[model samples]
Target: MTHYFSWLKNPDNRLKLLILAFVITLFPFVAVSFFAFPTTDDYCHTLAVKEMGYWGYQVHYWKTWSGRYIGTLISATQPLAYDSYLGYKLAPIVLILLYVHASLKFAGAITGDKLAKWQTYLLAFLLVFVLIAELPVVSGYFYWYTGYYYTVADIGTLYLLAYLFRNYSKLSSRNIVVLALGIILLVGMNEYTLVWLVVLSGALFFFGSVVTRKLQVKYLVLSAVALVFGVLSVTAPGNAARAESGLYPTPLKYNLLFSIKNSLAWQIHNFAKIAPALCVLALVLIPIACQLFKNKGDFKFLRAHPALSILVFVGCLYLSYFPSYWSIAEPPNLRGQCVITFWTLIGWTYNVFVLTFWALEKGYMKPVEPGKPVAWVVGLYFFFLFTGNFNYRSAWSDLLTGRAARFNKEMHERTALVLNTREEQVYVPKLKNVPYTILIVNDETDPAWASVEVNNGCAEWFFKKKFFYK
Candidate 1:
């Protein structure tokens, strides 16, 4: 046992082990992506783009539906736009890789060379795994074509943050231009992310100027760019049209109060939902925290204002909820919750590291050593992840039990039927095997149901015939 522990202690060996675990953890999710199919909005947006032309579709959506210019453009050009099933299957894989790349970049930027490459990759992998595994709706953020743009935009934000954090003090004029362009695109992608970036930039300005007494012109300029674009997005004529449609009916006061209340409740719920994984993450971070503390000078600012930092973290969470509630007069939808889950996990992990380092600095806890404790915790994490976590377990079940395959076959059959049918109106049977990892909104027999009408309308637009579900 001691010999085995010694072997695992080698950094290279540890990286290899972690890489293997990451691949294993990610396999089922990626495998099942082959079975994914576009849902309601996917058909709608693709059809709209085809009918209006790409640029025309953007203008139409801007005038009628949403102010998310970049999001609308991306949605219009999804794999389905070109009628490519193979591309559709490949979309999730691309997204997963992009997320890992962004995470690694951000990790490296933040740690500089204080941590080895393996350590940076370890932290990045941990972040990616937690975000993917604990998402409130995996299909919404990953599989659904219309929704995954948000994830893309979020990843873009991460990359932008990494660039800024790495180059802020010595940004070239070219870098500034790149930063501005990135912010413009990011704000146009989604209102939720726009709000997030704005809040984050504001916090940076406050901390840098007020607390540290060091003014950063780059932060101020970026904040102004975000605010300007944010106003332009919010004030779009389509926003008022969307509001008048009675989609979001909650009053302003109620929206404000509920956003705050639900923000706290959801964070607590998510924490409990992934408690075991979090425990493992906390244990994993202990050694990393100790390394950071030893190599980097004391993170004095991080520890100096613990109370303020907690408030800032909670405030960020509240802001995440506020934009969705204010827009829709309700909590964010499952797709939007992807952002919530993301920030919560990130905030929680960072807090864990900071608290651990603080404790070590204060002599309240002994210095951490990566050995038996981390190994045991990792084993428990994998056990809980594969057997207990609904997200991963459901994914494995879908792939192993042939549910995903059956679902894929059925969808392909439906597509064939739709394409071959000559009738103006067609009746199709409901899907029998719906995979848990895929979003399936079963069509209602009653056409009066808004969902049924929308689904039938989009299908008719796409297939040139009405579809009825029985």
Candidate 2:
């Protein structure tokens, strides 16, 4: 057992290392998609997709619609309309990959060459943190299609912004252009990318810490350009109407804070649970604190590193506030915003703590190797649990309930019944299968399957010739 543990600690143990990394990367995804979670707003997005037909259409129409310009594009371009369950199902996967890519690259850039082998291990740990933080977001997607779109759009934009900043020194003209294109893609994700623009503009203050004055000016300029494009991308007449459909409600003070607290607490609790080893590591920090201050004066570069880290942490914290308001008044996308916020801070904190320990060991910071053992012990503990648990069916059951089963059965039966009805158009009140409008939009493929839902507590329907149910 001791030999096995020692082997993992060695950098040369590449196979075990690779396996652990792979498991951590893939495990949460297995649990997320298989449950087939669906929220109420998903029907709305599906219906919206059924209405729009291309990226251009979303861009054109969403200018007026305030909600999700990017999603409108995805919905428009999808060939199947509401029938493209496959595209809808894969949405989270696509966003998750983009997120992981941006986060890892950003962390690497910030830490630079000073990041040790053990600290490099923190990258994989950070991935695990992203997953655990993302659980509620994933769960939210199972019910509301629109929620999925909104959450992904917000997190994805924030990550892209961080990735750009972290790699500012290395960014070429090509990268900047690519970042510009990425911003356009974010248009299809949601209009709330606008919120990201606001948060990132505020982050300019932190840029001076890590970037030269010349480059900092350039970044602020590019951010302004992206902000203009983001706003314009959602300015179409049709989209404006739809977007205005969702407005900032008069927020109750308690509701806003409560929602934010719940979102934060969920992530923090999971962080403690899924990464119990981290708790142990936290406890051993008391003695390690003495060693951290010892390195306080020797390495001047260390001074910049902590300052940069604190900047990143504070920026993420402030950005978190806007998402809270949106979650309360509009679509309630706390899950994605919460994950992004929690992990941003955790990643920075992990780096700071690890560096403190490493510095202490080298007599640059402190005189203790006490926290070193704690870190190793905790890392190994996480590796075991993360690899061993593949089937979290119980967790899925708790989150998704029997909704998937019920939705499938009901949808199937309802479709068959709708086919046999004599009415040329049918309005199914409380019908939840692919929203009746999606079926009507694809009337050429299945002419017998037209349906629509009741609007605003009024169960009324207008057929080809007349109105019923006034």
Candidate 3:
């Protein structure tokens, strides 16, 4: 691994290094997802798809009308939605690849020289770090459809922004179509993503126009269409229905100010969990990105004026979660955390890039000094900080995998019992660890167990019967 990283640092090699790093980072995510068994929400998502043929048009329309979560309903009813977790997960993996591809090209476009292979690898490192640090339940982000759409799919949309930024110059038919579709899908992912995407997209359009001294008509049109789709995404009739149908009570007035006010404390608390990582990223990644100081005085630019960097970073930190607190009724959930964390990463990256360019444009930077100990210290710090928080081995045990194993064993017994008797109530041990915050199974009110069978892959797999904690 040391040799590989050393070779990449040479800056002459093409981006082949990123492919290797990408695959390595992807391995455990795939492994955990592959073995991931369907949980409570997974069952409901499968049932939505299974029951699609049964729900009349009016009923479907009514459901969609009440709840504006078109993305959720669309993903829920997908034929491949609850297929092997690996298959369902391919979408986000492909998005990550697109991010790497586009980000490299975009950086190249900015500097008039293609980004070095190692830089791309650094981005891959940051992406994985963002994923592990911000997730409330790692498996749900990759494995469960509801969480997958809100978290992975939404983050994928954010990555696609890089692709758009890279290719926005072209007026090709393919680019137009892809951009439009991406906007709609992004809006569909959830409202928080919708708000942030629109803001970022609009800002990018404004900056591109100002920098080039020419209107980017394509991007302007793209931003306008994105805004339209965003409105449609949130106001979907189904959203209202879903909101009413949900067990949680809606506020009498739905005050936007109240939601924003109430969510600050929680979002602030969420930042506390990963502030160290964010600080490390702000300090280390910015200089590397600027390329002004490569060795001993690599951090001299930052060290010269520590307060300015902190002020800017603190601003980025607030802006990261600014759009997140608009839920208006309650605190944003885990998936909301996913969106906020992603935007935070994007905000940090964007801020660093801006800082680098400003420093270069104003000549407020130091000369590069080669063969310095500082580089080694920075490298060690990167390794230490990243390795400290991210633990794939620990994820296997902490994420309810053992409970899944136990759940599998109980299934064997449950199946045999059904074969021998027509019992109405099937007593089973309660699952101690459910992914996310949901109960393992809502047996008290939902007696049919039909949803369970669907998550198990249809009724024949396990006869329909009530299940309860022993």
Candidate 4:
């Protein structure tokens, strides 16, 4: 074991091993994607876009449902819009690849060429793996076309952040245009990410001006662009229409207070649920973070005002939650929660890295050397993650138990049945095996359930006949 650990210490060898592990970890998710089927909102969005031209669909959604201009455009162009089931199956695979690519770019940019390529890849892989494995709702973000706009917006945000971090010292005209376009598109994508961009851009401006004592005009410009788009998105007539349809109808003051309270509560709840896994992740990250810190310059702002840094981290969490609560007087839905989980994981890891560097700089703790124990910890973490994590386990289970294939067959059969049936209302057999990782919400015998009703309506619109489960 000592010899094995020593061999693994070679950077090239480690990189190869990590790559192998990533492929192994990713295979089940990708394999199962081929068997995944759209449900609920996926059908609804596809049917709407099919009925309306792309531009008309966008305008209709803006007037009645959402002001997410970019999101509406994305939904309108989903693979189902063209009746391409192959494209639907491939969407998750494309998204997962893009997500990892964005993560690598962001990780490399933030590290500023200080760490070796292997170290950067390791960091990116860990972040991507953890976020994917522990999502609050895997199908919502990964398999469902309706919710993928959030993922695309997140990828765009990462690329934008990478550009800013890589070019912080100077900004050319081209950079300014790119920044403006990125901010507009991101803020227009969805309210959840719009609020995130607002908070992040505001922080950049504030920290550059006051904390770091260096005023970066780029941050100010970015903030201004984000705010302008934010206003356009928030003030859309559809926003009020949607709000009125929300289950909770509180006054503005009460809503604000409740949002704040719920924000705190939800983050705490999420943290508590994932605390054990976080500890293991922290262990795996400590040695890597220590090495990254060695070549990177001091964390001057974080070191000088640690309390403020911590406060800002917590504040960002609150702001992320506020949009959901304010919009509906409730916590974010599963899809929104998945984005929150991603941000929280990234933010928490950054805090840990910063704190570790601070402790070492202050001589408050000894530097943790990487060796046999680190290798064992990493191996164990991956082992348990594959075996225990809900997403991975569920993916493997769906594939191994034939649930994924069965679900696909049933859905295709339903499609065929709908196409052939001439009756005003088509009754299809209920799904016998629902794949947990592929289908977010399945239909029921009764079409009166809210989600089922939406699905049935979409089917009716698409096939020109009502749908029901026998």
Candidate 5:
């Protein structure tokens, strides 16, 4: 028993964690494997990719910009969305792996080589849990283009932070180019995080005031660039168009009340839904807290910058959400909520770590190392709890095996219609499992534009017929 527990903390545990993270990340993709079908925004974005190239995107900005503002970086998604369905379908899973890579680097920065091999592996596993455990089933946030864009961008934000922290100590040319592209993407990729970016960067301006060592010209330039991009994102013509088309625009007072209500409501819902995972989180984090050094002396750095830290802490708490308040009173769609869900997890987790570190610095509690038997039990308990409550086995099976069968059947029928019909028209049933836009103008002979249908271009895209308009 002693041998088993000791082995858990040794060199081989990192290999175990690597396998574990791969499985956790693969679970969602395998679960939603059937849902790669293009939907409303994905189709539109795919078609709109042709409008403006590397030279000009604003020419058709008013068109595709209505749903998502990919900004100039819209050019990058070309060949992927237009050339083949497989590339677009697999992009999210690829991006997710990149996010995990970036997050691991960020964690390494925070721990600063203090973590043991097992601890690092456990941290990676938990980070994956934090990201995927609470995600809504068949969520477009994972599979669809628009939602996936924001998902990867926020993770990209973590990469940017890691770069900043490390680069200040040692500059790199490659890092500069990456930061430049990342900042530009944030301008259009995610407006929700953009708002928070501006808020947090402003806080950093004051934070630098106290930390003389941080008052570098490069830091100032980076902050300025972030602020400028953030402003451009908010003032975007597309953003104004979305607001102008609000379903229920309430008065300022009512909107504030709504934000307050939703802020708590969603927070409670997320915590309650992931209650078992939270328990596992406590179990894992307690052990880590024990290992982290216990300092008896006060943190004079925090004392000198109390207000700055408080502002940053508070900004992390609310800034990701404050942008929603300015929008309509109605609840945002599932895809839209991904931003809040992710950032809320980040903000809440960060504050908890800050408080934990502070207590460790002040020596709040002695380390709690379980006996071998107890430690083995903790591992089993966490795995059992996580799988039982959070994995959603039925949903995964239904979507991957069940819905995939349906998609295959539908495609077969769709091809049959195209071949049999001479009028260049066919009736493809609207799907229940997925949202598919109808092809408003599929007829090639009739050049005159027809009435735009709801399920626009679905048949043409499915069959790869390339009719007059998709």
Candidate 6:
């Protein structure tokens, strides 16, 4: 344990560890993309966007924009939603690429090393693992393209924190102001993300002193400015109205152990059928032990560094209390307390505990040759986490172009039908330009779609009443 603690102090080794951390982060998304879209959330959000196209927003932006805006302006200006599903699909890719680039840079900052060509390959593999851990959720989101924005928001916060940490020493007045501005922008874009962003930011301020004893007054001022700006942005009338348009005032639980258990269980259940061996090793048994025994800090470190303890405590508290939200107000609830806990704890165990300790205990205290076997061992460890899984590959391909196009085509035809239009357009909430537009269009192609029928009164009659359009 002493050896490991000693190893963490070495800046060079810390760089390698940072590279290792990124691999852990990226691999899960890559692996899961092969199985399913991240979640139906992406499609659902797209539906909202489609609704925006078909009708104007009801309460929040009622006077500002309507569905006509979507058809006329948005489609023309942004490639995100255009004439076809392909355009909609490619829209989120740009944000995701930005996220990936930001994350890579962030990882490099923490590791304090340039990612070599070989390291970059490993980085890709690691992304696969990160995506896998996320599993079906990532692929499910990939289908509609919009879901990626939610994820990008989440990951973007982490990258921003990494940026702050990496540039902790060299933060100038300009840099601090820019970071403050960035936080403000992020808050306006996504409130839930801002909540986690603040939590992470607080964690950095706490853990930072542990790594670097240099605490500058400027850093404190900058953080304060950022927090204030973030609050203002989030509280902006427009942003708040948007948030209220969705559900709110949900409670959050901070029970770490329980949340971790729940997260592990869900991941296992989601992936066990697809990748049993990997699931058993990574999600089920190994992580259990890793969380249970290995993460415990020794007396010297734990006792001496009361600040670290407090940071962990406060972070856990914030994480527990934070309400889980999605991109849309009526967004599908994926905010499992346990899932968040597992992700948080894993980062703790890997980056904060394992990698940090390994660096300190080994020759990290003194500069060692770059060819250390430990680096190789770390590389292999991440490789296994990323590769050796194949479920999501099929799932992703199925969603990308096929499903969206099919739905749009069917919807177009159904809306074209008089019976469909009368049934769907009746008594439904009207949008701006596309008032009384058909809500759902179905056909004989699938019994499911065929079973849905509507009448002149907009009364949706499902086959055997199995489903309701409303």
Of the pair 5 and 6, which is ahead by lDDT? 5
Worst 10 residues of 4 by lDDT: 443-452
Any runs in candidate 4 off by more than 4 Å, and if so which?
1-3, 212-215, 246-256, 298-305, 360-366, 442-456
Q: Which numbered prediction scores highest in TM-score against the true structure?
A: 4
Give TM per candidate.
Answer: 0.89, 0.61, 0.72, 0.91, 0.76, 0.52
RMSD to true structure for each model, in Å? 3.2, 8.4, 6.8, 2.9, 6.4, 11.7
- Look at candidate 1 and tell me the lDDT of residue 151: 91
What is the lDDT for 423 in model 3? 68
Candidate 5 weakest ten by summed lDDT: 433-442
Residue pairs with backbone overlap in model 4: none
**lDDT (C-alpha) at residue 153 in model 4:** 85
Which prediction has more favorable TM-score, 2 or 3? 3
Q: Write the per-residue lDDT of candidate 3 for residues 261-293, one digit (tens) a residue.
A: 555666578778766666766665566555633
Encode model 4's per-residue lDDT on 265-371: one tens digit a residue.
98889877777667777886677667766754533322434555577778877777777777777778888888777777766776777777777777788778667
> Residue by residue across 1-470, what tens digits does model 5's lDDT show?
78875775656775685667567645645545443544434544455555445335544553424323563354336433465656644665676677678777765554444676556655666766656656553345555554565676677777776665555445566665666567766656766666666666566555665577656555455567778777666676766666765444567524676787775565456557655555556665655645553421221222323345555755554545545664765444554566656665555444444555566556775566646565567668755655664334443544545654465355445446666767655554443332211111124322111113433443354334444422
lDDT of each: 0.75, 0.47, 0.53, 0.77, 0.54, 0.40
Q: Top lDDT: which candidate number?
A: 4
Order of quality (TM-score):
4, 1, 5, 3, 2, 6
Badly placed stretches (over 4 Å) of model 2 are 9-28, 31-39, 55-64, 75-82, 89-122, 141-145, 148-167, 183-198, 205-215, 230-312, 322-332, 339-364, 367-372, 376-470
Error of 6 at 316 (Å): 4.5
